[model samples]
Target: MALEKYSTVLKMAQEGRYCVPAFNTYNYETIAWAIEVAEEEKRPVIVQLYPGYDFYIPLKVMCDAAKELAAHASVPVCVHLDHSATYEIAFAGLAAGFPSVMIDGSSLSFDENVALTAAVSRAAHALGCEVEAELGHVGSGSNLDDFATGGKFTDPDEAVKFIELTNVDALAVSIGNAHGAYAATPNLQLDLLSKINDAVDIPLVLHGGSDIPDEQIKQAITRGIAKVNIATEYFRAMYKGYSASIAAAPDKDSLFEISQMSKDSVKEFLRGKFNLLKADV
Candidate 1:
């Protein structure tokens, strides 16, 4: 099938008590490997391209690669634009063939975030793209000690209002989850996540899935988190594969062998993650 709607897979995860693994991709190899493993596991996966890296990689190329790969995949594959900071970028993603786009207005004030999200939601919904909006700031993983730097924890009551006004399909809450690799194990505020879960009807998303203990992730899914974003670790896994391939290569210029090994690495990492979520999917 072609790219599935983000909500279709996420709502399934919410109902089945598992979180959809959203892997951020920057190139064709990454996109191909994501679908390759999802098909092998017979599970759903989200292929996300971060707009923040558009300076280095074109969004259109990423979108084309994912769409081509997902069209023939046996399992559900969602092509998404991850954390589009500006309305223009979200629209750009939509134009590039993203079935889902996330508008990151968490850095703005509540009202400001609402307005920005509402605008993007209106346009995106009309075009049949699911929108994921963030409330409260998900801070950088390196500076976990400073709440001020990462923004405040998402207010449960406010989360309800944000959903109603924006009319988004998913809400990403900041309950101590941050982006990139964590310096240490995170003590996720599952208690706060429960409150947000009770207050909202849409699927909840947890960013920074990398390095979080599996026990906490399972606990969060049991609570209400339906979508979990994993990036840093996946990139690390891909690099690990590339490094190994180079070390075992008979010649230094064996680009084909190195590339194939890198994909093997991606499939290996995904197999473990799929098994973790298999009980539900």
Candidate 2:
């Protein structure tokens, strides 16, 4: 399968009944796993890399690796940059041939966020890349401290205006979803999600999806969410694989074992998630 752009996958999600799983990839291991699952399931998927995540590594390696893996697959695999805080990182991802990039200015004021997102949108769009901007600060932490972010919520009215002015390809709203794994059960604000979906024309994204229950996620998708970002669970799987590799053999076993293990774990995870996403060729 060819690597499609984010817009193409998102449009399918919107018209279809479920969302597309956007898995975060930090290295070649996770990327391989994502592509494997996407191919097996024959579903469109988005593989994203966060800012400062293995920043020392070149982006081309990641892109080329994914491109190679995607070449013979049976599904669409789109690469993206997730939670980029600066124009430099965003531009790098675009120049490196990522199909999509997200500028997460949710930490800034409304006006500032709009300004930055607009600039990023222009830059990315000019390069034939899709841009995603976050509105309302989805707290930085996944625990009780998430509440301390002042419960940053996206007002439907503001979301409408922001999308119009920014012209972003997608909108990630902070409807009670935070980053990282939740220490407790998260109470997703479905009402806010409904209002935002009703107001915005583009696809809505749900972050911190790893911790949310199946029912909450299913309801959110039914209400009009097209993208779901997952990270912590995959991270946990990668760590567990490494630990198991060490415990099983103290010798200098090939690191590829750990990499392959992580990939398999994440593949299983994506299979389940895309099932919920109702992935179909």
Candidate 3:
């Protein structure tokens, strides 16, 4: 497998029982190590970078490293621009060589989201970059109210309409899931997820993959979630690894040694995900 179109990768995944984990990376270490781990596990993976990190690292630099690494890997990798709020941002991502870009208009009215996403889908397709759009609003973990409300969840009928209107490669559904650490254990609306999966033909995405129970994650996969976005947990793995390495080698370790030790943890974390996300069939 090599660097490939995200749409191709995800569409293939939609046919399987497991998802292709999309790991969010803000640094070179994460990207390089992530692909390496994917190679070790022999599983397809998606590498995503949020636009907010552009201030810290240039988008060109990020995309270049991810693409180059994926080109040489033994397993498939898809470079993606995650969560662009507008067309301009989505265009920037495709221009920067991302094979896929997500245009998020979840905060807008249905018609508005349709217009914005449809426009992006048109432009992105022209450039051969696939588009992913969010239907229901996925909110922050701090506000439990975000996931608790029934209206906020994706309506199966509306999901069908949204996909027909936008023609996105994937749909990110809000099903009792939130970003970052959960205020309390969340019971993912698996029933709603099933309805959405039954309603649409495209791959379904589950944001906030972090902190969900393994059984529930498996259930979500069984129900038709093809892409799982894991962010907070991966960052925490890196931090936990590096900090523990430094603490244990206070007198003997250099930055290089600490990073080498840290890769162990990152590798362990990634391996767990790759194994878990491997299709059941």
* Candidate number with greatest lDDT: 3
What TM-score should be assigned to candidate 1? 0.94
lDDT of 2 by residue, 3-89 (tens): 888988888888877799998887777887778887787778888887676456677677777777767668887888888897888
Ranking 2 against 3 by TM-score, winner:
3
Candidate 3 matches the true fold with a TM-score of 0.97
Q: In model 1, what is the error at residue 176, expressed in angstroms?
A: 1.1
TM-scores for candidates 1 onward, in order: 0.94, 0.91, 0.97
Clashing pairs in 2: 1-73
lDDT tens readout by residue for model 3, 58-109: 8888999999989999988999999999999888888888889999999999
- Considering lDDT, which of the candidate structures 1 and 3 is the better prediction for this target? 3
Report, for every candidate in turn, its global Cα lDDT versus the true structure: 0.85, 0.81, 0.89
Error of 2 at 155 (Å): 0.6
Q: Which ranking of candidates, highest lDDT first?
A: 3, 1, 2
Clash count for each candidate, listed in order shown: 0, 1, 0
Predicted structure with the largest TM-score when compared to the true one: 3
**Global local distance difference test of model 3:** 0.89
